[model samples]
Target: MLSGVSHTLRGLLDDLQAAANLRPGQMVVVGASSSEVQGQRIGTATSLAVGEAIVDTVLAWATELGLTVAFQCCEHLNRALVVSRSTAVARNLEEVSAVPVPGAGGAVAATAYFRLEDACLVRAVQADAGIDIGDTFIGMHLKPVVVPVRGRTRELGAAHVTMARTRPPLIGGARAVYDVETARQRLQGV
Candidate 1:
């Protein structure tokens, strides 16, 4: 089970990195259902062991890559997110008062909350990328102009996985220019 979770996470990262060029200080939000990972309906059979495996792996990988990681709570908690205090401060996110538990907040969020250094609950975040495991629905936390990435690892344990990475939204109608080189030239007073 542990190995499966780790492999799935690695696969998700590979797909995300391929699509989004993540850099230092970027944020990645994840929403997971341990029950679904165990082949049960979401919120019905949450498992701390599975949650710990996923959370630990995510935190370690994100930290090593110099990225911020956020874990989204289940509908039981109104889909609030668990993030590091530094992340909240840096991103100007509103911090809420709540401690996640296995049953109430869901095991994945609980494990991430307990494992994160200086963890805090936030109402929302515009994450650069996200992973939704077991249909937990993490779309609301992503930045606008989300580009979905079809990854090689589609499932983790017994759960289905979905991944996304965001980019700047394309603006302007016809006759409106949106070229990076042109923008750079304008910025230089060309």
Candidate 2:
């Protein structure tokens, strides 16, 4: 089961990266419900082992991509995220107290808290990308210009998967120049 989950996640993330053009040092937020992975209702049948598998898989993948990953806790923890201390400091996220447990933070977050090199909880983050397993609702952590990424492999175990990546929001009206060359030409005309 662990191997299967890891493999599925790897494929999904690969597709996301390909479509999103994610770069190094960017962060990805993951929200997972082990109960959903097991075909159970959310918060009904948490599985620590499944959570461990997910955290391990995601961390390994992120390492290979030179990206950061954060695991979001359940609503019980106010949806706070589990991230590395370095990430928290670098992103200027406010540190919060409280260690995640299976009962409160859910299995995935608890596993990430223990697995991360220097795990800490943060109130919020504007992640570059997101992967939601079991309908965990990871939208809150993503940047404003969220774009959904669809891949061939949809489900992870019994859970539904949703992925997204963000881009800088497009501002200004139709007349606003979006390219450097266009802007330069317009300025010269002026």
Candidate 3:
């Protein structure tokens, strides 16, 4: 049975995946504050149950989408991320030495660390997309050219949720043509 928070998060993640057109193996960074989810000040209260719901829900969606998920620790850990060993190896991310505890690393990250197989901490990552629950600020983990995704489900429990996807940086200036059709039309002087 899914908790209310889990159910809401599932819908939000589904909407984000569809809107962003996320592909298999793409990475999604998640930063959550279980305290905020329970309507408490961030870091003031940590709920293991809320954290479990978040980690479980996100992992289930990641499995279904064939995506890689990273959980961001709180600033107490310098915002390090918990990822699978495979993800660290595949992405060539430097491994950090530290175990996440609920009080320091944030509940969601701590839960993820235990839940993920061969879990390891990485110093940093540039993921394809990100989910920020309770304004935990996942922006730093996302790739360049971040675009906000407004999903149908706005809040997870009492926490405000924000989602984002990244696109490749647009290099050329105004004279640059984006599509073949546009290039053709410009060449024809139409």
Candidate 4:
């Protein structure tokens, strides 16, 4: 089980890098449910241990890549995001006052809150990319132009994995010709 989780996290990091061109210092929002990943209902089987393991794995990789991580809270916080205080200040996101409980923010978010340094909850953010685990719905946090990313690992345990990378909106019609190859190359981090 540990091996599987590690493999899934690696695949997710790779996909996010390749598909979103996630460079160093970029922010990525993740919405997850350990219960769903364990084949249980969304909030019914909340497990701090599972959440910590997942966060530890993912954060190790993100740290190596110099990327910032944001964990999305459950509906109890109105799906607000928990991120490092630096990220919130840099992004100019408004901080909200709230401590995440198991039932309130789900295990993953609560674990993130506990682990993060100077952690704070924000109402929203326009992240460069997003990862949705167990159908937690992170689309709203992603930038305006979202492009779907399919990783080698489709599912992480019982959770369905979905990824998205945002791009600038395409302008100019008809006579305007966009460089499709360049765009693809950019996405692949070439």
lDDT of 2 by residue, 23-106 (tens): 899999999999998899889999999999899888888999999998999999999999999999999999999999998999
Ranking by TM-score: 3, 2, 1, 4
**What lDDT is reached at residue 6 by model 1?**
84
TM-score of 2: 0.92
Cα-based lDDT at residue 149, candidate 2 = 98
Q: Which ten residues in a row have the lowest lDDT in candidate 3?
A: 1-10
How do the residues 33-139 of candidate 1 rate in per-residue lDDT, one tens digit apiece? 99999999999998999999899888778877899998999887889999989889988999988999988789999998888889999999999998899999999
Q: Tell me each candidate's TM-score.
A: 0.91, 0.92, 0.93, 0.90
Q: Predict model 3's lDDT versus the native.
A: 0.92
Q: Whole-model lDDT for model 1 versus the true structure?
A: 0.89
In the predicted model 2, the residue pairs found to clash are none
Off by over 4 Å in 2: 177-190
Candidate 1 weakest ten by summed lDDT: 168-177
Candidate number achieving the greatest TM-score relative to the actual structure:
3
Off by over 4 Å in 3: 179-190
Give the higher-lDDT candidate: 1 or 3.
Answer: 3
In model 4, the clashing pairs are: none
